[model samples]
Target: MRRESRVERSTSDMAGGNRFYFPTKAPESPAFYTGRAAFMDTVDTLERAISHARRILSARQLLPVPDFARETFPATKPQWKGMGNMFNVVGTRMRPKNYKKITSLLNQLAECYNVAHVGDAPSVARATKNVLDMFGRVDAPIEDLEGQKKPVTIDDAGRAYARGRRKEASARVWVIPTKTTDNPSVVMDPEFFHEKILKSYRKITELPTTSVLINNVPLAQYFVNPADRERVLRPLKLTGLLGAFNVFALSRGGGTTGQSGAVAHGLAQALAAHVPEADLILRRALLIRRDPRVVERKKAGRAKARKKYTWVKR
Candidate 1:
């Protein structure tokens, strides 16, 4: 839980700026992690960051450490408004499919040592309501046939357990949300990943409304050549969105797939939020209208949950 600073801390009258404490892995590995020098008023930022790092560095006593393709990079806590104040959590896709998990998130209303996060509490409540309501839309199990209103509420949670379906939406939502990470130390959470990654992924998979974002704009040139079809997929069936209309998306982390998914997902959600009915079209088109939980993580994970698991072609 404690790491000694390796990089030499320094300050100079030449550049005359905030002091910095950069860190590196071991001598054998490439120094993939580093941060800019900045002022620190509290240890809160660094402590929160290391909590996640502790899980990654050795996986601790929680769950098995996921096998990411590359070394997990520790984030540099930057100085940005409303950045390090709240916890950084990754959004996930399992909620719709897993009610127990949804319930668990709802039940976790901040335990011992974890005081009330009222703002976050409402979010969790809303998510719980959504999953429970949507479950009935597909698998209605209630036979009450009497007391029911328009939009469901927390009181409806218990009923959902019986009904087995939400009164409104379906659980098959092409765009599933999964909370993947929670780093409280980060300053600027690149909006590309925090906002738009999953929407793009769902759009590609569901084929509802077609959207494209170049995350790796640098890779755009490959599509220009047309031969890199290997890299930039051409229009096809299973290749889904990855085939046709190559979207260029460039991002720092959460992996290449995560970045693409976020862009596609965010785009779809935006369309739905602004244009209401567009979501139906998107779902029909096979591009799932994102559930809008792309950035909020319901549960903490090791490094990035999706990044792990080395490839196996078998």
Candidate 2:
């Protein structure tokens, strides 16, 4: 007696006139359904179970399924086509609780169906790792953690105010626009004066003169050194807004150098606040930076910071 081939048995199992004989139901056990139909049926069952779980969880208000998951894993006919795409059904808004529940259900289904035999679907271990990695991430909130305050202030009189510090010295400065009628000085043109009377009564508008007062004293009297005077006025000259506004500063502590530097810094910030357009220029020129340098302290074995004792071999 000779054994029959698989083709001969399949042909004989078909109906007399029909070309196909579809199974009414899936195999009882996972091992029996190891073909394409088995894989498609398993995928379809998992999809249905997920949908049902989502509805139940949503109705109970336990876990609300995200919109992304619904859009990605829409209900479709059970077919072997695109079975591998089922692994892409991760939810975007599922929190930790929902993630745990869904993953647990997935693991249970994988075990029941022996999903390990289906090579097309992602492995249960890999999917679990990916899901855990994706949902574990959290975005940080954006905020000003340092609580820094602005350097400039405005007064009721429309004046720009600022404070500056340098080496134990600090200055409070205010910049205000100058009024044309404040000073009625005339410019004497040589040509007109020479042709007419030596002293004619011709009133002409003169360039505005910037007046800077420190502690109720004139800037010239306060800072005797020409270099100190220039340092304090450098911010105005650099911005080409000299004589555009009046500066009233109150500086104390430290010597002339520190006081001048502090006043310069304050004036720069006040100018930036008043003009608004010259902020970038003043910032680039480094006039707004507070000097961080300080006098070095004396060491135990040295007279000064690095000045050591006289070398003695004895």
lDDT per model, in order? 0.30, 0.63
Per-residue CA lDDT of model 1 for 1-314, tens digit only, reads: 55434332233222365545436446432322322112121122333433443343333222232346113422211112122222222112223333343333322311100111122334433433343232222122234322232321212211110011111212211221112222211212334343544665544333323233343344444235434333222211222322112233333345344433344443343333333344465566444433333443344443354454455699
Q: For candidate 2, lDDT tens digit of each residue in 202-234?
A: 454454557999888999999999999999999
Worst ten-residue run, lDDT, model 1? 157-166
Kindly give the stretch of ten consecutive residues in candidate 2 with the minimal lDDT sum: 74-83
- TM-score: which candidate is best? 2
lDDT of 2 at 26: 62
Cα lDDT, model 2, residue 30:
62
Q: Which regions of candidate 1 are displaced past 4 Å?
A: 1-219, 222-250, 284-286, 289-314
Question: What are the RMSDs of all candidates, in order?
Answer: 24.1, 26.4
- Model 1 residue 197 CA deviation (Å) reads 36
Best by lDDT: 2
